[model samples]
Target chain A: MARYGLRTVALVYLLFLLVLPVGLICWTTFQDGIAPVIESLTTPSALHAFKVTAQVAVLTVIANTVFGVGTAVLLVRHEFRGRRVLNMLVDLPLAVSPVVVGLALVLVYGRFAPFGGWLADLGIDVIFSLPGMVLATIFVCLPLVVRAVTPVLEEIGIEQEQAAWTLGSKPWQTFRRVTLPAIRWALAYGMVLTLARALGEYGAVAVVSGRIKDQTQTLTLFVEERFQNFDQQAAYAAAFAMAVIAVLTLLTITLLRPREDER
Target chain B: MATLYLSLIVLIPLAAVVLRSMEDGLSGFWAQVTTPEASSALKLTVVASLLVALINLVMGTLIAWVLVRDDFPGKRIVEMLIDLPFALPTIVAGLVLLALYGPSSPLGVDLAYARSGVVVALLFVTLPFVVRTVQPVLLELDKEVEEAAASLGAGRATIFRRVILPSLLPAMLSGTALAFARSISEFGSTVLISGNIPFQTQVAAVSIFGQIESDNMTGAAAVSTVLLVVALVMLVALDLLQRWGSRRG
Candidate 1:
């Protein structure tokens, strides 16, 4: 077959787009000598940003795990009126820009707005607050979990669930005993993606967080802020850490596939 | 109530934009969305997205083909890398491009291309969409067809053109539509790399953000309204094409 020539194009394409950029990021860490990168990572803000990133990621994952599973079951199991609309609505965030997602929150939470005024009367802060950052991240990353699990549920079949229920298993028990393990890999995969997304989200968080240094800034915004501040080493350091986390998460999702179903 | 929650969040803000857009009358709204600035942004977005998607079509098809057709060293790592952008926050993708082409970066200085830099960055981040979408199609492609084509003395190119490409085209179209929708609203990566220079680097989505910040809701809504229309139309067109292509297949 003349497929041999096509294979060359495919390999080169992979090398240029996927492999090279990752390699470039890795090389960037050591490009200006190890000292700068090392020193940058050691900085308290850089260290702090990494800790916050980890913390936020963990929180986002746990929240998504529950929410994702619930939403998936709601989406797949419940055949209600406007089911199609609900499906599309869940994925609306995917089509909207993260910036708009942030604005949506702002328009809801601005001082003059209904919710914001009440919260402010109580001295509550959202814009430029930790809550704002998490809310925006959650908004942007909402679809990933839903998308990951719904497909698995449909493809896995439901005879097992019916059998469990027929055998007198409670509704929740049927799901726990018969369905959870079936989609656990998908759950894990979605969690990893969500973790990576929360750590790196900036557009939504940027508009909402107000880029307040150290308090609500994410590693991504931290990198951008440092770039504007002309702190290249710190920017690189944050980018490097994010890159590491991304590569690791990507690794996890691909390696641990469920026994059945395509990823 | 299912749609009720969605309408409050998704439909209300969107409808406000549309209502205000037509409130000024159709001609005025047309003028607003088709101004030189808006047209250039629209032109760049559509043309650039098409260019990027076309490029990814070939690249994605090839990557998918290789992964399914052959085994290689670090195959799993290569596969993982292909999906990296999907996991990446658009902002992180933008950050990488900024590092790649900021005025300080060699690529930035050497290229001497001002606005195309934004296109380059957008293309980089959006590259994954088509690739990820097309890979499964390629993976599930029946290898037996190729063998049958080979036995019929069909050349590899002929086999692919007649056998594989035709089967994959529907998926590619659908994937490209998804990629187009994604690239249009891609403010995070483009904002940093483009520097948001008006009439040049400023795209529709960025302009919306600019207007919102300035409290020019009318103007912002106009731009966003155009984007919304384009997104709806593009998605519809893609859906029709995919349906037709699948039926033909």
Candidate 2:
């Protein structure tokens, strides 16, 4: 109704940019009989990949939550040498190529590197192991939690924290009672972003992951291996499952973010 | 403690990639990454990234214009959907493109070139950043000037060209730089659609990492150095432009 032209372009852009491509993927996934797709998705490798993805997501969320909360607090409250550099370094992993992150870890943890021999002798197996995949996820996903929490911490300001301190609440108790409640939404926001990212990650995790079937294979890597092996149905099915989770997580984030009314 | 953890996992390994390359003399390292294959991968990466960035330059600005200038239904939804790619896993983006442009797809079957699929893959993954970066600037734009241009009997095209285009130029350039920076490092999506073929569709990020998988650490280091240097230069350039834009603002 509004000059029709702008609306048409908006529709076309959305169709091309978001709807059609995602729709096409969902359609192909359900091809070859829904049963076959479902069966493939339930297979051990796909299941393991999903399970591993969940485990890594959980571990990463836990690790980065602590790291993110502490970083936001330290960053907002403390002044120290190299604080600016530290702030910049914290954001580096966000922009670092996942391929680079993976390869970097592979070099350090693979059999040829110095740490690899020590780890191998200890039977710790970092490369091509579950631990390695989780570690890579943590490295890449670290920035999300920090990004979410830091902005909120800055927004809420330090007046309340100072008030609690003035009220003679112990440092730990003030942090726990006053600061944590104020930042809970930001914390949830950060954790959700980490979980979503850890789920979809491929390159870095794939490199150090070794893609061991039913073991080290994360969902994204599993999809790649399946596609490369020309198990197209399995790949599509797994991709569909991942897409569903991703879309849900995204919607949740959008819903939880400060609304127009809130602002 | 977390910083130490991050340094061990990220910074040290990153340094190691550079160190391995420099262990060979600079000339020797340069010689390795300058091979015909490496040259072609770099070429492909630059061209594809530029193509993606340029396309997004037009489309992103239009979307930003729509979001900023117009009040419409589903505006918030559109804003969030624009951000979908940022959180969308790159691998899934690749898969999405593969599903859209593989041989069986309606357009893929009739495309001018066989490798149009790779372009589509790069396009989807790189589109959102350009859009996101530009959208914020567009929102933050001082609109009185554009409205003034409109009242002066300037036609739509004239207004866009003479008024809006100049102001949006810096953000567009910075966004394009970011788009290129991002597209070059793109491996997850490219690897899926390119079929990992060497010397043709293979990207630098993929090829360099492929060397790592094969334990050709020295050779991989050489290629990694090239990518690292290129990325560092581009990032520094982007930082300067961004600072310049902020200062002027």
Candidate 3:
């Protein structure tokens, strides 16, 4: 009886909090049939938003993957003075509000501040441009890959790399041949997480992007703009598409988990 | 190379925020943080986050316990649902909740433009923290101890309170702290639902966003500093808790 009661409570909580809300949005998106949903997604502005989201997500993932693997290897294998502090600082981005993230970037990189002014003089715009949006997304998604790969790197140890080094392999060769194979799944998992976060980022991008439609508006900004302008259909449709991406990411993560665990 | 990226991307910009907040000295920072609207928003955020954390401590633990100890049909689906919040876009999360609980709520339970609406949004975004934290510890737990307690005639409640709860508390608290920090900093999920009414449903993150929109950079930076301090403190606490948890285990 107690077990049944607990199950009921858990199910009810998830039903209302998780399942139902997501289901309702998907249902609402299609209530008017497929034409509006498709049309809403294919509008010129919507398509542009899609392009921007993709470009930013891809760049962010590539950057984070490199940074994540380097940081993980450094944290797990190398000894350094501020290693612990670096570990904690890697997590700083997660603790920050996305809005603060935007504000932080703007303060340092906007055209007014000293560094930003210098960059502006060089005709290199950082804030309120594609570079700003990418930077914001990268900041918000920075820790995912590092966090994911660090544990696996720790478990793998350095014996294999050491053997390769002893056999005359160069630094890059040892990493490419031995270390890379062991951590590939974990690295893949981390990239997936980074991609998911990059694609979903809104608040930080909002502050930094300047939200000029068809220019800086990513899909998330598009959703908010559409909803605020009373374009509920467009908002819901864009939202539904994003939701599908999220769900598919979840499924991919789930599938990858066992394989990640197997090694 | 890694240090270079971390310094440029993560460290410098954050330092800039702290420096910006101190531009007018400590008094100016204090004044910005203590404005009636700013203070009220900060208070609301802290209170709502505390409430959300306390609730998560209980409900999150319960869900983790069920996932580990209980079995039922479609359990895998429930497991997948647990991470949906983390994976979903925050704006979409706000929209979905509004669809269900907003003005035109099919269930007729309109929470939009209300403080409760703000809490619900935080809860949705933070749903994964505690459960994810506690589930692994529960899985690693040995059943032999419970069997030993049962053989000694320990009641179910006694076994739980004495045997299980002790081991679970650290992970539980860590998860709770992470959730609290997250709720304090939450923005996107609360924006549409809370309606951003000052001294009402507005949270600290939304308050910061508003300050930035109004070009009150100093004020925004000051309030942001407060949040950054709180989040840093929580991270330190989390570190200590994890070290303690590992030591005990």
| Each model's lDDT | 0.73, 0.79, 0.95
lDDT tens digits by residue: candidate 2, B97-135: 766666566554522123566677767777676667777
| lDDT by residue for model 3 (A63-162), tens | 9999999999999999989999999999989999999999999999999899999999999999989999999999999999999999999999888989
Between prediction 1 and prediction 3, the one with superior TM-score is 3
Name the TM-score of candidate 2: 0.93
User: What 10-residue stretch in candidate 2 chain B is worst by lDDT?
Assistant: B106-115
Error of 3 at B185 (Å): 0.5
RMSD after Cα superposition, model 3: 0.7
Report candidate 1's interface RMSD in Å.
2.6
Expressed as tens digits, the lDDT of each residue in A1-263 for candidate 2 is: 54367667865877775777788888888766699988998887788888888998898888889988888788888898878777767866755677777777777877778988789898898888887888898888877888888877888788998899999999999999998988888788788888888889888887888777888888898888898899988888888888888878888887778641263
Off by over 4 Å in 3: none
lDDT of 3 by residue, B22-76 (tens): 9999999999999999999999999999999999999999999999999999998
Question: How much is A145 displaced in model 1, in angstroms?
Answer: 1.1
True contacts kept of 3: 0.87
TM-scores, one per candidate: 0.88, 0.93, 0.99
Tens digits of per-residue lDDT for model 1 on A1-263? 44667667776766654555556666876888878888988777777777767776777777667778887898898888777766766777777777666666666665666767798899987767876667677777777888889999988888999998889999989888899988988887788778888888877777777776777767887888887787767776677777777778777876766344454
Candidate 3 chain B has its poorest 10 consecutive residues by lDDT at B2-11
Better of 1 and 3 by lDDT: 3
